[model samples]
Target: MLSIIYYFVFNIFIGDYIKYSCIVPADASFQVYRDNFIFFVKVFYYFRYFLFCFIIVIRLFYVKNKFFRWLIKKICYFA
Candidate 1:
C-alpha cells in the first residue's frame, strides 16, 4: 500500500520533470524523445539489477581482501 502510493507520487514527479524540462507540449513530447527515452529506460532497468549484483561483488571482494573485511567489520558493525 505504502509502496503503491510512493510509485504514484514518483510518477507525478517524473511527469512534472519531463513536462517542464521539454519545450514540446505534453501530447507531442512522447514523439520528441521516444528513442532517447526508450534507451535510457532500458539502461535504468538494466542497472537496477546491476546494483544488487554490485553489492554481492563487494561482499565477495571483502571475503578475499582480509584488510577490508576487518575494516568493514569494525567500522560497519551491525546486527
Candidate 2:
C-alpha cells in the first residue's frame, strides 16, 4: 500500500512535468493533450491492477503465518 501510494505520487509529478513540457501553441486545441493524459492514466491503472493481483497471489501462496493470513483477510475486507 505504501509502495502504491508512492508510485502514484511519483507518476503524478512526472505527468505534470510532461504536460508542462509538451504544451501546444496558443493556436492549437488541447485535444491531443487530453488524449495523452487519458492514455497514461489508463496504462497506470492496468499496471497497478496487475501488481495488486501479483502481490495477493504471492502472499496467499508464500506466506505461512496464521496471523498474516488473518491480516490479509482484514485487508481484503477493506479493499
Candidate 3:
C-alpha cells in the first residue's frame, strides 16, 4: 500500500506539479509578449490542456487504489 501511494505521489502529483509550475508561467509570459507567441507556444498551450484531460482519463483506468476506483466508477456512472 505504501509503495502504491508513493507511486501515485511521484508519478501523478509531483510530475504535474512540476510541469504546471514551469510550463504555465512560461506560457503566460509568452502570452504577455504577444509578438513572441509563435506556433510552438500555441501548440504547447493546447497540448497542456489536452494532456491534463488525458491524464485524468488515464488515471481513472490505471490507478489501482480501491477508493479511487470506486470514486471513478461513481463519476463515470453519473456522467
**Which candidate achieves the best lDDT against the true structure?**
2
Candidate 3: where are CA atoms >4 Å away? Answer: 1-48
lDDT of 3 by residue, 15-52 (tens): 55545544444565566554343444455545656766
lDDT of each: 0.59, 0.67, 0.62
Task: Say which prediction, candidate 2 or candidate 3, comes out ahead on TM-score.
Answer: 2
TM-score for each candidate, following the candidate numbering = 0.38, 0.43, 0.35
The candidate with the higher TM-score, 1 or 3, is 1
* Candidate whose TM-score is highest: 2
Model 3, position 79: C-alpha lDDT score: 92
Model 1 TM-score, 2 decimals: 0.38
* lDDT leaderboard ranking: 2, 3, 1
Candidate 2's C-alpha runs over 4 A off are: 1-28, 65-79
Worst 10 residues of 3 by lDDT: 33-42
Worst 10 residues of 2 by lDDT: 19-28
Q: Clashing residue pairs in candidate 2, if any?
A: none
